[model samples]
Target: MYAIVEMAGQQFKVAKDQKVYVHRLQTEEGKKVTFDNVLLLDDGKNITVGAPAIDGAAVEAKVVKHLRGDKVIVFKKKRRKGYKKKNGHRQSLTEIVIESIVAKGAKKAAPAKAEKPKAAPKAKAEAKPAVEKEAPAKKAPAKAKVKADDLKKIEGIGPKIAETLVAGGIATFADLAKAKPEKLSEIIADVRGNHVTDTWPEQAKLAAEGKWDELKKWQDELDGGKA
Candidate 1:
């Protein structure tokens, strides 16, 4: 069984015996704390969701330790002005081990454990060792396949953006098309009043062009007339 718990203004999805670090709380080490704000609970086959929070649902945890985060150095300086300052800070933290997650009115769930796969039985008898063969000098690794005009098939990409990306040596559909999370923020800044980030245009471009396996989902849906 697992629980969705709220602690120090953060929500965590955790299971029994798992240790989590959160903003420090005023509980002593080895003390027990119960998080009553259970947002959701799951016991494999069934799930219970809270209305804001579940009444009488709670997760029990043992405070393992009170600790401090690594010190961070903060430095500020103004160019051409001889003004500079440095400061160091460390954040307080708490380590807690989830003990149990219980549904208020339901019986405890059976513990889930991972079973190891059994080993295959030994061969009936060891075969005589054959004279080693050089196996055709093992073929060389193949070069990565490249598609030069993959961007042309995507619906939303214009010739200008295609030229811009292709000029930057991005020739294949498998090339990174989606701007990274940080890069997306910069793109948002460049667009000013537009909310293009919500569209994830680059990812959509890759999906439409069939560069990733996830794109097959959309293709399948379209084929099924579900689009």
Candidate 2:
């Protein structure tokens, strides 16, 4: 029998006694772990597939060891901007051997969150005045339209970097201008390429101050978001 399972943000195919290497997990070495994210199972002649992930299905494995992968070089450069940056990184990994795949009686995985309860019905006698109700409804959509700014306007930020900044709650030009470059680098550590953030705050400051012509002038002189 063989099964396809997900673990530590990655997927793999495995069978009994088969070993695999994956991203490092929080579990210690020489310990047993069970993953309840079984996506598919095949037993010789029959097959089972999940709606998203099969319920009550699981895979058991034992952590054999922990190690780090080879170092990788990340380099970045911008044309005519005299900008160049390079760095190295290594990935942490774990080795595990599959012990078994269970199709039933496994702890059920909670995939979706429970829906919120509906608000209680309003009292009939309290029939609210229509004047008060009309204003709130009109204001709701106006507030919703005030969305985060296009943070990519800053030179050094690419799609991934802008997404990271948004996810970290730094979504506006004003907000980015107020942030420290050190904090920006720490938040964007997951981005693939090496980055220089020294000039990001200054660019954001220009944008926030509505100095569009000046900001564009400065950006044209920049390379790969570097000054």
Candidate 3:
């Protein structure tokens, strides 16, 4: 019998005693781990598929060792800009051997229940004489709309980063100027690439003050907004 299971953010077709390498897991070497995300299962003559994942289905495995994969070279260059960069990376991996596949009857962890707040006691009302009803007051005038600034104008901020900043409530130059570098990084944590935000607040401050010439000069001296 063979089963398709998801482990360490990747899927694999595994069977009894099969060794597989996957992304590094938190579990230590020689420890056992259970993967509950079985996507498919086949037992010789019958095939079972899940809508997403079948309930009570699991794959048990034992961690064999932790190691790194082959080195990969990354190269970047600009044809006429006289820029070239080369780097090498090795992916951390873990080796595991599948022990068994449980098609059903696997116990799932139960979630903790929250205690509900107790209801307050009702207040008693005193008897009072009814007076003539007054007319409702007129509504106040609506406030003027505040337009969102173009955050992309800030150095090193692309369209995706701008959208992410806007969603995080930093929609204006003033807002960006007030944000800390660490907080800004947390806001755009999902954005791709290595982003340097150390100079972002200063650039935003200059933009907020309408110092276009100075901002332009500073941007010209910067390499992708790195100070």
Candidate 4:
């Protein structure tokens, strides 16, 4: 099971035992935290999408550690002004291990109840009829196929990331087209830690604009280290 949860100002899609890093929270290390803003849940069989977020659905996580991100160098330069400034900054972050996911009001199977003693069976001799009723064969429900381009169809997904999403069952243009940036960000973060924003929404916008060739060209440039 997996759930899409919101923490700090960002959303995260997490599954059991998965570790996630996000903006630092006030909670201490090793403490348990519950994310109430559960936007979606997938139980392998069915996906429950939240309208603004599913009511009564929650994701439980344990704080693993509090740490700082790698130093980011900020360099500013002015042409002909001889003005140059260099600075470094590190962001505080929290590492969390996802626990169980629960959907509100989901029914649990009840344990077998005790039964009373059965009465003695009556002895009766009867001839069995040769006629038999045929039981109708049950048909299996059709499984939805995840498409390779569906992930790319989302508002902020790239080719490689789209491959991951498609393999993970997020196939279909409509499925990805309906996904929010925040939700897609969560999925991307889960896949490629900390680098989800580089080319997500932009790619999605291109798909939405029917600019498949342009999108592929841009992706090629990025892959070729041109950008």
Query: Against the true structure, whose TM-score is highest?
Result: 2
Q: For model 2, how does the per-residue alpha-carbon lDDT over 19-119 read when each residue is reduced to its tens digit? A: 99876666788999999888888889878888778888889999999876675666779999999875444455689999998888333466688899886
The digit string of per-residue lDDT tens for model 4 on 1-227 reads 88888887788888999999987676888899998888888999989887777877888889998887886665679999999754444555789988888887443345589999875444321222222222223445779754345554432345777776566555655455556544554454455333333345566567767888997778654421113
Query: Which lDDT value does model 3 have at 133?
Result: 23
Q: How well does each candidate superpose onto the true structure, as a TM-score? A: 0.44, 0.52, 0.51, 0.46
Off by more than 4 A, model 4: 105-227
Between which residue pairs do clashes occur in model 1? none
lDDT over C-alpha atoms for residue 28 of model 4:
85
Candidate 1: 10-residue stretch with minimal lDDT:
190-199
- What is the model-wide C-alpha lDDT for candidate 3? 0.80
Instruction: Candidate 2: give the clashing pairs.
Output: none
The sequence of per-residue lDDT tens digits that candidate 1 reaches over residues 1-227 is 88888876579999999999976667899999989888888999988887778777888999999876675565679999998754444445689999999787433344589899886555522322221234335657889876676554443234554565566655555553554422332322322121222223455565646566766455443311112
Error at 28, model 2, angstroms = 1.5
lDDT of each: 0.62, 0.80, 0.80, 0.66
Worst 10 residues of 4 by lDDT: 124-133
Clashes of each: 0, 0, 0, 2
In model 2, which runs have C-alpha deviations exceeding 4 angstroms? Answer: 105-227
